[model samples]
Target: MKLARLGSPGQERPVVVLEDAVLDLSSLTPDIDGSFLAGGGIDAVRDAVASGSLPVLEGADSLRVGAPVARPSAVVCIGMNYAAHAAESGSLPPERPVIFFKPPNTVVGPDDAVTLPRGSTKTDWEVELGIVVGRRTSYLDGPEQAMEHVAGFVVADDLSERTFQLEISGGQWSKGKAAAGFTPTGPWLVTPDEVDHRALGLRSWVNGEPRQDSSSRDMVFDVETILWDLSQYMVLEPGDLVLTGTPEGVALSGRFRYLTDGDVVELEVDGLGRQRHAVHAYEAAAR
Candidate 1:
């Protein structure tokens, strides 16, 4: 099953996409929340689908979409989880996953404009696979157990402000990663049963030109390892999002140029869905 949030930012309503049609799950008995997916919520929705009791959403063409999950408790990101990306960034792959956080406010729906932050000049893009946790998990037994914790998957653009990321500041990378609207997530949140995580191919395009193109199989630390490692550090709760890291071919890879105002970035992953965003320069008074 594929879950989504539809309508304008701040006014988004939960939805489920099956084939070409969208279902307004908001009208159902179960409330729309992150835990819905993490805590056997998918099973309920599946039963509803089979029973034909779910509302078939019409006029969905008129509603704008937001991030699938309304408000994640935290957004965790993994750095250099892709060897080729690490190599391009002039660093070797880490022996263990490097973790960071992006404020939940950074989350936004797909197609929303990504505002370049003030006093920033090196904004860049990263297309990553985002895992949505379905339950509270601590010290997961192993990879298989870790997989069970995942509720679904979504496409995320880990938009970055590079200068603030590595320059003058000496703090964590989260500073550059947590800007508002920095994370463009979800046209759809596909359940694990509906898609094969290992076989999916992800690709990103900047202003209609392709940039990152790779498969989840290329991940140095796959989804299971990431979830397992993450649970070891802190409790993984429902609605927590984990960005598994971007594949090779980012601008930071040194093979292409960075983003500028009015540039549109597009990204997609097999079975999950696609996301698009327009880039604009930040104005101080605008924030």
Candidate 2:
């Protein structure tokens, strides 16, 4: 029962995370997206915070956390479901799932501030696991019906640029994955009955060092078989956000060196939290 989204960026507000405070889901739902997780809203915020009737989020510790879900309609991704990150990007492990799509306005905010685009030299960093769909999936019938259409789990990064994703704009990888903030997801969203999305634990770091530690149990294709192989084609609505890929130390196998201009990306997964950004240099925002 985590589900955050504090203030700033489109005026976020929804909240819930507790262990000692932060409740107010805006009088019970106004934006956790996908119409509040298809209207169940994590069982109505766990029975309104176990009947205490929610309403504590006063300061929420100086607000500004955003991206805990809100503004999604598709941000799917899944390339190289991690078989050593598909042999370190040279590629070879693909029996199915390798979809792509990252442009739901390139959602940002898990410690936002990453630009590095403008003839970018390769700017990489991945660390994923994000799911979040909760209803309206399509053509399921497998992978245990895609775990009843999931409704939680965050911690994503997927910020690539690798020469606009593989050299030019023809191979088609969301054209180097929709730039802007390049996805950088949430600080919480959690809920699939609490977590254990197939043995979580996917690490990453850049300026602080360690690149990508890896372990969604190596994931050759886990987590309800990538939502039953993306519901056979496409339709996952309800706050859509997939991701589920990155691992095997990034920097595109060159071993390291790509992101520049400050470099600081730190990501984590374990209990679905942790993300930090800091590479800037792209300005251009005066239209």
Each model's TM-score, in the order given? 0.95, 0.36
Per-residue error (Å), model 1, residue 187: 0.8
lDDT by residue for model 1 over 1-287, one digit each (tens)? 88888887677777778887887777553444665765577787788788888777788978888888887889999999888899999999999999999999999988888898888788899989999898888998788898777888999999988877878548779778978999999888888888989878999998788898899998989999999988888997888889999988887776887888888999999988888888888872275
Model 2: lowest-lDDT 10 consecutive positions: 278-287
Task: Give the number of the best model, judged by TM-score.
Answer: 1
How do the residues 1-287 of candidate 2 rate in per-residue lDDT, one tens digit apiece?
88888898999889888888888888987788998889887897888788998778777889889889887978888898888878988888899888989788788788978887776888888989988888999988889878788888899898989888888879778889898778979888888888888889899888788888868888889989888878888889988989888988888899888888777889999998898988876753321
**Which residue runs does candidate 1 get wrong by more than 4 Å?**
29-31, 284-287
Candidate 1 lands at a TM-score of 0.95
The numbered model that scores best in lDDT is 2
The stretch of ten residues in a row with the least summed lDDT in candidate 1 is: 26-35
